[model samples]
Target: MNHAATTDMADAPVLDEDPFSDENIANPYPLFERMREMGPAVFVAPHGYYAVTRHAEAGIVASDHTRFTVEGGVGMSDIRKPGAWRTRSPISEIDPPEHTRVRAALQKILSPLVVKTWKDKFAQRAEEIAEQAVARGRIDGVADITEAFVLEVFPAVLGIDVPPERIKLTGELNFNQLGPNNERVARTLRRAAPIMDWYQQVLQRDHMRPGGFAEKIYEAEDAGDFDAGTAPLHVRSFFRAGVDTTIAGIGSTLKLLSEHPEQLALVKANPTLLKSAFEEALRMESPAQVMFRTTTGEVELGGVRLRADTKVGYHMGAANRDPRQWEDPDRYDVTRQTAGVHRAFGVGAHVCIGQMISRLEAESILGALIRRVQRIEPAGEARWRPVNTLRTLDVLPLTLVAG
Candidate 1:
């Protein structure tokens, strides 16, 4: 494999060519292919950041915190620099020692034991949605299935009393804030502005429902497991991290399976493959499309020199499909063994801590759906909703055949 081509570092594409522009965002494979072939690291001129499109480079950038620090902020735009409206994620922005403390505390409350307890809840919710869609014979996957399942169950586990309408709006704001300042960010910011105050109130310890993880965080706070006042933020962190990504992930899986009949057939025949179906979808169309890190010192990646404090964007969607790492990279294959390998949930110390919960949720929900669905045919064309840092399906229409 000739990996040594003199990569033209200066000629990389611009973000105004809008990677998230409606057309490209809906189907970004063509653009991802261009970037992956361009180099391991290519300059995204419009956003003025380097994008690591290769699987290897994405992994390196994610794991090597010394070279790429999260302190600068995890979006294409630097949240630390002046005028950025986004506040740092107490969980994602802070690196180790501090990050370790916060993450460890949350991990204990979200342990496998706690997550396993939700299996019945997720299974019941999945059955309800799957049965409805199965009865209908045709369904809009995003609205009728994926969003319904996640929005129904995620909040229940968290013990939040959020309204259904607010879920999508809140997700839009959170994910948009993770990207560069753009129309998508601006629009979602406006949409979420009115509810911002109420959003704050719901995350507080006072609002936490009894027996929920939010309540457990308060218990930890009371017991001196974490800073006295950190409980609200701790609860807020789960809402921010867990919600939209899971919706986008499960939505993408449904869209992929609908579009690829053969793959759907495979999953139906071997129900265990439902897990891999979700993994393959996460690989092909990542939920968190990019995560940023700032350089603490001068560094070089793929021969391009970067200065300290410079931001780098690792495109997980691009990395997952990098031809160097995946054979027939764009194709969705249920048996690919791609679960832990994909950067969709990220890597290293800051890798998504709630991954097991996400997996358990997806497996339980998707598993139930697969068990009932004999075939999933495309009911209509799907559309992608462009957010700054996430890739998500806005709509997915799928027709199902009952078992």
Candidate 2:
């Protein structure tokens, strides 16, 4: 591909690296630093998309819907283009006015009272899991702790009845579709093919258990809060957004705590630091690594002009670690204040709607472990699962010492 004059913006650096490659997916910080240094917005030649690598520029791209819109879809490829993923999500894909109304209805269902009610149940489950993990002495933190707890509790809360394997398969499929359609997407789709029918059925009203979040979504649809036939898609949006990302975050927290005993000590002493620990871990690794937005028109970002109707990728993992945003950006400081500023949960109007739920889940599990375990040490090598667009652990081997 010709690197010369790819975009009208002469200053925009053309980066030839494939951000989604297996090597980069495993360890992206080096590439992230390079991308940030190249310019705020670098045109990726391999993917033919401009990447916003700095914290400030990424925020501008994500928040300013008029200039950078989601109408083209949040993935690397535009949904309007050929060979794209299925239609855009009603929640994440639409611009405001319409998005505002749908979001308001969903917010009503996930009100504080409802979240508080779920917290009680989550705490109970966390304590049980903590006790079991402590007794085991050594465990795979991903499979044994984060995945075990979230897969059971979150699905129960959503009123969906599906096995853990199916959930993992579908989560992999969802994240892969958000990136360039490559061998990874092909592989995941083939693997999930057998259960695709069941996956669709489970999100439907008939499969939603009474008195669960899924059922409530259907109820809201019946009341005309959502357009007809969009209820199932809403349920799907929640499942796709809520589950794997939280699992990735909680798992990353455990890995961080295990690797840094002093940070773990701080959290164990204060207990309140568990929330900070989770946030810091998210900033360090960032579960949802990259999201896309298309240019609504000619837009100036980071002193460079991007052409109209082009896709710009926000590398969240890169932005969260941008030195311009945080001092010693690479260090995992549990006390670091990153809530609103961090690009992990996102920024502006489309900031993750289910963030409170994720926090509640993380606090419940991490709080239980911190209270019960004296020390969290690495038992073996930690392995990261390579989904096209998600940064998550496949296995985190840890040893729990009883308090």
Candidate 3:
């Protein structure tokens, strides 16, 4: 746990690449390779933070919270500092003891029984949507399938009732704010300005529908499971963390499946591989690409010495593709054992609390499709959405052939 410096700061390689630049954001694999090749950790001069690029080092930083803490916030900026745009999530931003309590309460609310019940509902909806998508033949996978399925079912389970347009706007705003304050962040904030009020109001306890999971969070808060007044923030955290990431993940799964028909065939031959398909997709293109942690003191990461209280960004997309970790990192092989190994959902304590929910949702939709469709082919180019820290599809044109 003690990461007291054993190496000189000069050993750390410094690079000037702008990680959030339009070109880099659009195609980061090249830069990711460069960063990983540089060393386990490299100082990204443009962003003014050290990046943990290699899979092993990223795991070390994530798991050993005593050395690299989340208290400074999970974004590029230290939330403890002045002029920070983000507020600390009562769940994600706190470290053990405090985080432990909140997470336990959340786990109780999202129990296995509750998740299984939701899975049944998700499966029914997925079948309905998959039937329609297969019938359509040609469709924008992002809009018609991924967004349609997740946006409908996820919020319904959360007990939220917000327009899809507003959810997308707010999601973009939240993810953008997690990165450096740039033009993209400014633009998204401006676009989301109109819905800001409603976004806040929707997470309030009164807005929660009866018998939904979100209502359970409020109930837990009332029972002293959480700090008073922390209920809304918990609701907000679930909404922010749950929606966009799942959409990105599911979209990536479909895109990968469509492009790699052979792999899709593997899943079709044995539908059990549906979960593996989603896991591999997430590994190839992680939804939450970069998450930041603060160095608690002078620490040595991948043999590089970092100064105390500095922000260290873990590029999940980069680490997930680290050749050191997997046999063929770039290739999307559905059979790869990537579920616990990949950095897609992260590692250690702060590993996404809702990962099971995401997997279940993905399994439902993908299982439904693989069962009904004979083949999935790319109809056109798959365009990447240029969110600062999120790697998601903007438009995926696909042609689905029925079984």
Which candidate ranks first by TM-score, i.e. highest? Answer: 3
lDDT, candidate 3, 114-223, per-residue tens: 89888779999999999899999999999988899999999999998988988888888888888999999999988888878888899998899998899999999889
lDDT of 2: 0.91
Single out the weakest 10-residue window by summed lDDT for candidate 3. Answer: 1-10
Estimated TM-score per prediction? 0.93, 0.97, 0.98
In model 2, what are the clashing residue pairs, if there are any? none
Candidate 3: where is the Cα deviation over 4 Å? 1-10
Ranking according to lDDT, highest score first: 2, 3, 1
- lDDT string, candidate 2, 1-403, tens digits: 1223345555578988898899998999999999999888998989889999899999998988988899899898999888767877889999897999999999999998899999889999999999999999999999889999999999999999989999999999999999988899999998999998998888888888888998999999899999998989989999989999999999999999999999999998888888889999999999999999998866778778777789999989999999999999989999988887899998877899999999999999989888998899999999999898999999999999998
Residue runs of model 2 more than 4 Å from their true location after superposition: 1-11
List clashing residue pairs in candidate 1.
15-18
Give, for candidate 2, the lowest lDDT window spanning 10 residues: 1-10
Candidate 2 or 3, higher lDDT? 2
Off by over 4 Å in 1: 1-17
Model 3 alpha-carbon miss at residue 315, Å? 0.6
